[model samples]
Target: MFSLKAALAVPFAKFIVKKEQKWINNPLETQERVFQDLINDAASTAFGVDHEFASIKSHADYVKRVPIRDYEDLKPYVDRVVAGESDVLWKGKPLYFAKTSGTTSGAKYIPLTKESMPTHVAAARNAILSYIHETGNAKFVSGKMIFLQGSPVLTEQNGIQLGRLSGIVAHFVPKYLQKNRMPSWETNCIDDWETKVEAVVKETLPEDMTVISGIPSWVQMYFEKIQEKTGKKVGDVFKNFNLFIFGGVNYEPYRAKFESLIGRKVDSIELYPASEGFFAYQDKQNEKGMLLLLNGGIFYEFVPADEFFNENPIRLTLKDVKVGVNYVMIISTNAGLWAYNVGDTIMFTSIKPFRVIVSGRIKHFISAFGEHVIGKEVEQALKEGIEGSNFQISEFTVSPQINPESGLPFHEWFIEFENNVENVSDLATKIDAALQEQNSYYFDLIKGKVLQPLKISEVKKNGFQTYMKSVGKLGGQNKIPRLSNDRVIADKIYDLNLIK
Candidate 1:
C-alpha cells in the first residue's frame, strides 16, 4: 500500500521539480520580481511609508532609503504590531510571531504573515519533493516520519499567536502526512526535552519509522536513548529508516558518531530554515551547497563579511555575488522586514544556479586577540583533524582563553569525545595545526609568540548536554555556538565542573 502511494506521487514531484528549475535558471530575474512585489505590497505600511518605499525604484533606491537593521533595531515597529496595530510592518497584523531567544535581546518575536507562512511550508515540502525527484525515493513519504520539534501549543499576545518557529511549523504540517507523523500530540507537548525524547523513543521503537528529522545534537541524544533502551544499533531497530533530515548545525562534525549509532549510513537532506525565512535547502545529494531560494518571497543583499562592521559597507545584490567570498546576508521579506540583517554569514560555492553554504554568524567569532576566527574555519579545522582518525567527537565549543593564569593566551577547545582517544594531546595538536593553517592571523599570532597553541579541555561525558540543560536551552532549535568571542560559555562550563 505504501509503495503504491509513493509510486503515484512521483509524477507530481517531478512536475514541481521542473517548475522550480525555471527560477533556479534565472535567479536574478526572479529576485527582481520578488523585490518589486515586496515594495509594492508594503508601500502603505508604516515601515514602507517611513522609508519611502513608494518612491523606491531600484535596489539602489531601496538601499539609499532603508538602512540595514537587526531585530533590536526593528523592535519599535514590531512593538506596534504586537500592540494590535494594523498595517504597521506588513499590510495587516501578522498571523503569528515566531518567538525565539536572542543573545542581546531577551526574546524576539519575528512576524509570520499570511503570505510569508506558506513559503516556509512550501520550502520544506519542495526540499522533500526535490529529493524524491532526484533519488526516486518517495517510499519514506508513506512511512512514519518523526520530526523532533517544539510543542505546537501557542500563546496569544494581543490577537496573534506566538510560538517557536519549529512549533509554528508543526501546525502547518500537510494533512496527508499527519497520519504518518510519529510522537503523539500529548508526547510532543511535553516541555522537558529529556522527557520528550524518552517518550519519542518509546513511541517510535515499535513503529516502522522511515524518516527522522531534527538538529543533530538533540537527535544525537534521541539516538543514544534508543541505543540505551534497545541495546541495538538504530538501524537494527528501524530497518526502514533511511532519510535523515537535519538543520540548525553542520552535520559533518556529527557524521561519524551518527553512522556509529545507526550502524550504517543513510541519505540526508540539509535545510536552511530560520525564524526570518526559509532560505535554502540541499537540492541535489552530491551538491556542495544548498540551492538558495531565489523565487521565495524574500529579496536578498550580500555585504562582504570583512567590511560588514564598517560605517558604510557595500551591499551587493545576487547578481554581484562572487563564489568563495564570505558575505553577510541581508533580507527584505513579504513579512515586512526591510533591509534586515539575519546575522548569518554565507559563502557562494556555485554562482551559476546561486548555491550558498552558511559560513558562520556575523557575531559568533573569536577575535579576542585579533585573529578573527569564524565558525566555518573552526568546523573545517576539526573535520580535517578528525578525518581518517579514530577520534569521534560528540560535541565541542571553542573560546579564547585570554587570561589563562599560565603562559600566553590561547584558544580553549572543550570537546566531548564519543570514544576515548589514545592520546588527547595528539588530537589537540592536529586540531591546532589545522586551525593555524586555515587562519593566517592565528598562525602569525602563534609564530610571533604572542599566542600559544590551542588547548583541548576534555568535556566529561554528556557535559555539553548538561551545560545546555543547565542554561534552559536543552532542545527545540537550540544549538551550541562553535565559536565565542568571550569566555561567558567557557566560564559557565567550568563553573559546572563539566571539564574532565
Candidate 2:
C-alpha cells in the first residue's frame, strides 16, 4: 500500500509531511496536540456505521468523552464497517484484511485501508532510517536484502483476502526491490503456512543471499531443513549473509540456540509490526529502538498501564511517560482505529525521540488462578532471580491451568534448566521468591507452586520448546500466549506431557 500507491498519496502525503515536520525531528514531546488532532480526524470521517464516533461534532468533545477501546470492542465496529456501513471506526473500501491469530480469540481479520496505507509504509521507512541513524551504518541501502515474507501472489485482484497484504506487496513493490524479496508464492498461503515456507526453501537454498529477514522461527526452520537436505548447516548457507532482521515476536528464548545453529555472527533486527500499523523497530547500536510513529499518518495517545483503563484512566502525552513504566499504546490511525489499544505495552528506555522497549503484550498476562502475573513482571522476576541466584535458565513457558482434581487453577511453569550440577528445587524456590519480592500480587494470590523436580524430559533433550513446536507452532511468533486466563489451551497443554 505504501510503495504502490505512491502516486495517489503524493498530494495528501504532502499535507501530512507539512503537519509532521515539527515532530519529525523527534516528536515525543507533542503528545497532547497529536492525540487531539487524531480524534478530530476520526470524527470527521466516522465510518458510515451507527457507531459512537460517527455523531461527534467536535473533536475536543469526542476526545474528552470517549473511553479507551480494545480489539474485541473494536471488532463490532469493524463488523459494521465491513458490512458496508459508514462509521467513524472505518472508512473507504478496505484495501484488504490482515489476518492475525487474535490474542483473545483464535483469529482476527483486520481491515486495511488506502487512507492508512501510508501509516504502515512511513512507520516501516522510519524504522529503517532510525536503525541506520542508531548504528551509523548505511550498508542496507547498497545491499540486496531478503524479506522472507509470505507469498504476495493473490488469488483475487481485490486485496480483501487473508494473504492479500503480502500478495499485493509482491505484485506492487517497486520493481527494483522485488527481485531481492525472499519467499516464493508457495509459502504465503492460509491453506498451510508451512507448505508455503517449504517452497521458500527450494528457491533460496541454492542462491547466494547476502541479507535475510523473516519471522525468526520460520527462518531458523528453513536453515535446519537446508542443513538436513545438504548435510551443511546454517553457517554454510548464511556465512556470507551479513544481517538477520526479524520482528513478529520475541527471539530471546531462542537467541542462543540460533547462534549455536548458525555458527556465525549475524546482525539481528527486531520489528514490531501491526496490521493495524507498523509501529516500531530495533536499531543496531541501541538495543532498544526509537519509535517513530507513522507520525505523519496517524495520531497517538498514551494511557498508563497500571491504572484502571475502563475507569477514570489517565491518558498522558509522550512527554509524561517515564523511562521504565509500561503504557498501553493507543492510536487514532488513518485506518479508523480511534483510541484503539494495540494490545502492546512498551516502556520508554530513552526519551530522545522516544526510544522504547516492547516489554510484552498487555493481554499476555497469566492470572487464570486469580494471581495476576504479567509477562513483564515474570520476565523481570526471572531476570532478577537469575542474577541474584546465579541460576541459568535456557527457556521456559508459563501456562495457567485448572487441575481437574484440585478444582482450583494454578500457574505451571515449564522451565528449561541450564547445565548445572545441583538441585532443581532450589532454583524453583529462588524463582518463586523473586516473584514474591518483585511482584507482590502474584505471591499473595498464588495458591500452590508445583516445580517439576526433573529438569529434563526424555522426549526432548534441550527445553520445554520441543513440546510446543510438536504442537505445530512457530517458536517466535506463535508462543503459547500466557493469558488464556482461561483453562482452554492450558488444560490441553497440561494433558499432553509435552516432552513425553
Candidate 3:
C-alpha cells in the first residue's frame, strides 16, 4: 500500500537533508549573532515606547529597560496584534500563530513572522542531525519522514492547542518540499491519529523508516504495534532506522517500554518545543542534556523561580542564569511574543554558556507516565459525576491508562471520591463517558479504536491523601499520572482494582 510517489521521494529527501544541514549549521556562534541582532530589534521597539511620539535605541538600555513581561501583562498586546493594529508588539501581519494548550490557563497564541522561519527550522531539524551523530548512520531505505503533531488548521474556538511545532511547518514549506510531507492539511494528530499516518507507521518496514518524530508515548505505542504485527522485537525496526527523534518531554517514563522494544539503547534526539513556538533543541548528537536555546530568533529573559512568577520579576541574562535552581523561561521571539511566558519550568545543568534540564511544568500534572495530563480535567469530571450522588471525600486522584485486554485505551480513575457515593465505579464510568461525549477528540479516539473506554479504581478511604502525603508535595506538585494510556501500567492498575 505504500505510494510509489512517496518511495521516489526518499532519495531526493536524503540529498536535500544534507544541503539543509549545511545551511542550518553555519558557524558555531553564528546563531548567537543572529540572536543578538533580533534582541536589538525587539529592544529598539520596546525602548521607543517612551516618547508619546517615538524614541531611540541603546544596547544596554534595552537590557536595562522595564522588567520582562508575563502572560497576564501581555494579553492586551496580543489582542491588539490579533485585531491587526500597528501595535508596539508586532510590526507586520501574522504569518501564522502557533498555538499551545496553555498548560496553566486557557490557550496561547505564539506568532511567527517571515524573519523567524530559519530559527524554527534549525531548532526542529537538528534532531535529524543529532540522530546521525548518535546512531552513526544516516542512510535510508524508503518512505517519507512522518511527523505527528497538531493539524495546520485550528479547531477549538478558544483554547491553546497542544501539538508538535513541526506540524505547522509541514503545511507552509514550499510545494517542491511539500512532497516530503504527509498527505492533507486537514489531518488530526495527538488526540486523533490520522489513519493514513497510522497505516504508514504500521505498514512501513522499520528498516525503511530512517526518521520518525512524534510524542514519546505515541511512538512507544507504535513500537509495540510494530512488534505485534511483525512478531519481531524493536531491535529489528531500530537496526534499520538511522535516527529516532521524539518531542514533548523527558523519555524516562517510556524508557523501559522503548528499550524493551529495541532490546538495547537506541540513540534518540530529545526535542524541546512548544505549540506556540519551536524553542530549543539538541545541537549535537552526543549531547544528551538540555537543548541549546534558539537564541537567534528569540530574546530570552529568565525569571528566577523564587522571584520569577512574583508580582514583579527580576530578569537574568543568558550569562546571569545560575545552575541547580529552577527558573521560568520567558522569550521575546521574532514570532511577535515579547517576554512571553510559556509556563514551563527548568533547572540549569551548566551555567557557563547556558544548559538546563526540563524539570516539569509550572502548571499541575501528576507526571506519573509523564503524560502531561491536566489534573483539573479529571478532578472536574469526577466532581461533575458525583453531582447528585453522595460521594464524599476531602481529595482524590484519577489516573488514565489503556485497557490491554479490550484493546481500547481508557481512563482507570483512581478516585478518593467523598463518602457515601454508592456505586463509585458505575458513576465514574458515567462521568468519563459524559466528558468524552462533550469532548470530540476523546470521542474520535474511541470511534477510531485509538482509545478504550473508562473504568474506576475505588480507593479505600484514606489512601488518596496518604499517597500524596508520602511524596513531600502534599499540597504541591506530587500526585499521580492523570493520563496514562500505556498497557504495562494500565494492566497493573486494572489488576489491583483498588479492592486489593
User: Candidate 1 local accuracy as lDDT?
Assistant: 0.93
Model 1 vs. true fold: TM: 0.99
Q: To one decimal, what is the Cα RMSD in angstroms of model 2 from the true structure?
A: 6.2
Give the poorly placed runs of model 2, Cα more than 4 Å off: 1-37, 47-60, 86-91, 103-107, 133-144, 151-172, 186-191, 287-296, 368-371, 380-395, 401-410, 415-430, 433-437, 443-477, 482-484
- Give the candidate number with the greatest lDDT: 1
Tens-digit lDDT string for candidate 2 (143-227): 3466656546444223354443444455555554566555544455434455555666677777667677776655666666677
lDDT score, candidate 2 = 0.59
- Write down the RMSD of candidate 1 (Cα, Å): 0.9
Tens digits of per-residue lDDT for model 1 on 191-272?
9999999999999999998999999999999999999999999999999999999998899999999999999999999999
On lDDT, the stronger of 1 and 2 is: 1
Better of 1 and 3 by TM-score: 1
Can you rank all candidates by lDDT, best first?
Answer: 1, 2, 3
- How much lDDT does each candidate structure score? 0.93, 0.59, 0.54
lDDT of 3 by residue, 1-500 (tens): 34454355455446644654553454235445654565555543432353211222432454455456566667776666555554356455555566544434576565666676666675665555544444435453234455655555543322323233455666556453454454345444323443534664554553345566676645654665678777887667656554567766555544545666767776667777664456656655554455555445665667776565477667765656677666777776666665567776677776443556666555534333333334334544655675655555433344555334556556566654434456766786777676665456666666676666667666765454344444332321123444433444334444544332
On a 0 to 1 TM-score scale, where does candidate 2 land against the true structure?
A: 0.78
